[model samples]
Target: MTLPTPSTEIRPDLVLLAGRVRTGLGSAADAAETDGTGRETLPFDAVAVRGRHIVAVARRADVDGWNTSAAEIIDLGESTITAGFVDAHVHPLSGAESRHNALMLHDCETTTEVAERIAAFAAERGPEEWIRGFGLSFDMFVGHEITNEPFARAFGGRPGYLLLFDGHSIIASPRALERAGIDGTRDFGNNSSIEVYADGTPTGYLIESDAESLVTDLYPRMPVEARVTAVQNKLAEFAASGYTSLHQMNMEEGDLDVLRALEESGELPVRVRVSPLWRASDPWAETLRRMIALQGVSGRRWHVEGVKFMLDGSIDNGSAWLFEADTHGGGLEPYWTPSAQFTHAIHALAESGVPTATHAIGDKAVEFVLDAVQSLPSHAANTRHRIEHVETIPDALVPRFAELGVTASMQPIHAFAQRADGCDMWTTLLGRDSERAANGWRIADLDRSGAIVALGSDWPVEEFDGRKIFAANVTRHRHGSDRPAVDPHQALSPERTLRALTRNGWASIGHPGEGVVAPGARADLAVFADDPLSTDPDRFAESRVLLTVVDGQVAHRDSSLA
Candidate 1:
């Protein structure tokens, strides 16, 4: 639990004192509340940062003796400081670009409201220009009312592409489909489909990337300059939320270029590790080769570190690769053409010293990925290959995660956002009996088995908020409702959850010591309104972020902190 000493004492760039700081010095404790009862805990009262690295983290008296009056001093006044959060899996660039021109519909509650909002947004677009919008929730189309008629009436026959909030499903206007040359007769394999009427006319609802790309590919994309500004705006949002680093998943070639430019210009507010996507249309070897080349393209603030593949679609759309279900005709489908392609790609990439992060939601998908990881050569055992969104881990496979050293990169907010009354789109598809065993996040179980677990918001799929993550992991309950906990047994202790967001997330992306606050570590810290360790776990949501510091520089400071 102790950090090594620095070679020499030197003046720091900044000093922070008068706070209860969680230095993130040790492995996660069994439970958050009863941690370090008998063990000697490290003292964390103040911290000193030199350049972009921490120089001292000890009691105030200890840190003060080494530093003179040259550094900028900040008195935290009983605030709490912890390692800045690391969101392991996020898609921020696209979502940030969407905010510039796309019609934001995440706030709408009812179908009528959504239609009304779409109508108003469509009224502003030209007849020929594509009307693009995003953030349409899954529940909005529960009755399958997101057909072409409302879209046609609203857009006045203009081509339009409205992406659902989850990025899995899309409902396009008839004109948009016609413009994209998409007819109902087009078949997109087993996992992906274009919903059509009995007479073979299209319903405008497309599932999975293959089907949705038909119209989205035709939509005019944001220009490079506009995209850069949007990304900058998004970085400000992340810094304000106390995030110091991000594991950017599902990045495109253009997105990579934009990130490089940002890093070169010193505009990046947080450190980024990007995972360029391996599209299904491309050959496995070709994609792996391109992704491997990108591993060398890295800067201090951003880098291409891994490859991302979607093994299956979201569960809400009945596209997830699940086991033989008693109902829903066995919900199982693989996004890759040849199922072996994933294993082959994972091996080739791992052999090149590049890790793979696959999106696997269902139990079968999870198991298949674990098998692929297990099949890797013994030399690649420490590759740290990850299974993104281990949403459902079969009881038998839970222990295998530790044995194989596969990181369970999960999104806890997903459980709170999707589930209601212990039932959600995922559970509704898999009957009640199967839901209990299958809709399991099983994060606590994964930790207990000695497996590494990292948590993230899976942003754009869910809002990015570190406070909500803490609350969600502790309760697994809805924010403002009396709905029962989604899965009480899956709830992790606050200490464990914090480790997942900080140390575990950083290590998963190949930076183990980065998220810890110690000598020779990056100086990224988050200051909260209350001491998280002393505060009640249930009241975590109420604690506000008072300030955020990255690279020993202040990124965000609430006026109240002054």
Candidate 2:
């Protein structure tokens, strides 16, 4: 597995010396170059970078044979090079806010631990500053209700707002409730409720959309300049984790303006595919005009590719819009607006020649999205509609995605993190017999049934770590545990997992040659400290990104390089 040595006469624009390279291959022509050994054989010891493109990748032997003048060379030193990680569904703004505003609860094992952490965080901040935190789990608090009493006591008079890890529930203190102007009477749809005691006092616990909306309204968003700085910091974090590009899900027009400003000022370091949130109240003509006007806005740095639509709520909050109530007799309700409203919104987006990516979590919600897709005229295929978070799709509707040419954009880490809760929710909503068919991240099964699977991490909602995500996909288990592993037969191979995170993400958004390392492709690549393909899941999880190059520009590197 030795790379060809660099010849004294062979010079390249840039050279990346690595132990291995994993070229993202989506077709047989790309597949033929690698033997069944799952490794790439290159003739050069380095990759030559010219301006913002990779001019040549050659071994030392061929470097003298090709033009190498005016090139920059990087030595990887026994590491591996692969296509940069591309996250498809992320809330960059929220993720940035989480870096500062909220108490991070990503790995707490119990509710008491969560309370203690919030209490500690509140104690350190000034009295007037809002105490906001994220990543609380509903399942963790199942038996013990999330009352504001504990949070209020912990806050010691400071206002506290704790967002459930799913981002669908919120536990607010009495002060926060008063600040948001929400009383016990607010209706949040389904079992969605603003929890108050029998005394009619606000309980500080809000479920589903009501709770999420309250926190959103109460938290003073950062100014555009601050947001730009936060996003820039987030980009560095992403690059350090081996990502060179990301598709921002649910972006608003104002957010796009901020991104444009950053790009114009040469502050944006990563490529972005922006999907604006779509509302029914917007005039179709005006929306289309604005979308068309945004074409070529950032000279390939930013793209407005589609519209994001919410079809239903999350599974964790018991608002997933199931076909039936929970068998546990808790009166579980579906978390969607009226069916008529959803149908109208989907039709409008489809007819406007703009692609739509609907967030649907429950089987019933998936059905609603599918029905809407089926209702579209045959010409609607031109829009390339996608169903995001198809977490609990019915077995019967699985093939329909392929038949309709829809992309199943899913997050594999969600399955690993939420599997127990999701199964419990499904079993409660549908009977145990029905639970047998509930599927999560059935990658091979979905692809076999004719679906195009793309990967994403709903960042800030949950921590986005690409290595952990990829390891979860292949190992089907969290690190150091064999318990709760997914069906091994349905797990994806390491190579396929890489493709889903890279090329499939690009293809999902209508960008073709962006994720591969071949000639003529955008020079978006990540260099790792070890060969990811040969490493075990634990080793893969530990693999550090040594360098990130986007459009042939060095965006991130180990601190040692500085």
Candidate that would win on lDDT: 1
Q: Put down candidate 2 lDDT per residue, 34-103, tens digits, no spaces.
A: 4468766542335665556655554545455566466665667778788888988887755685557667
Model 1, 463-539: lDDT tens per residue? 78877777788788755557678778888887778888898997886777778777888898888887665576557
Model 1 C-alpha RMSD vs. true structure (Å) is 3.5
For model 1, the superposed segments whose C-alpha errors exceed 4 Å read 1-4, 27-42, 140-146, 149-151, 417-423, 435-438, 536-539
Instruction: Supply the global lDDT for candidate 2.
Output: 0.70
**Candidate 2: which stretches are off by over 4 Å?**
1-12, 26-58, 144-146, 187-193, 197-200, 252-254, 264-267, 279-296, 328-336, 418-437, 480-484, 560-562
- What TM-score do all the candidates reach, one by one? 0.91, 0.87
Query: RMSD in Å for candidate 2, one decimal?
Result: 4.3
**Candidate RMSDs in order:** 3.5, 4.3
Q: Residue pairs in steric clash, candidate 1?
A: none
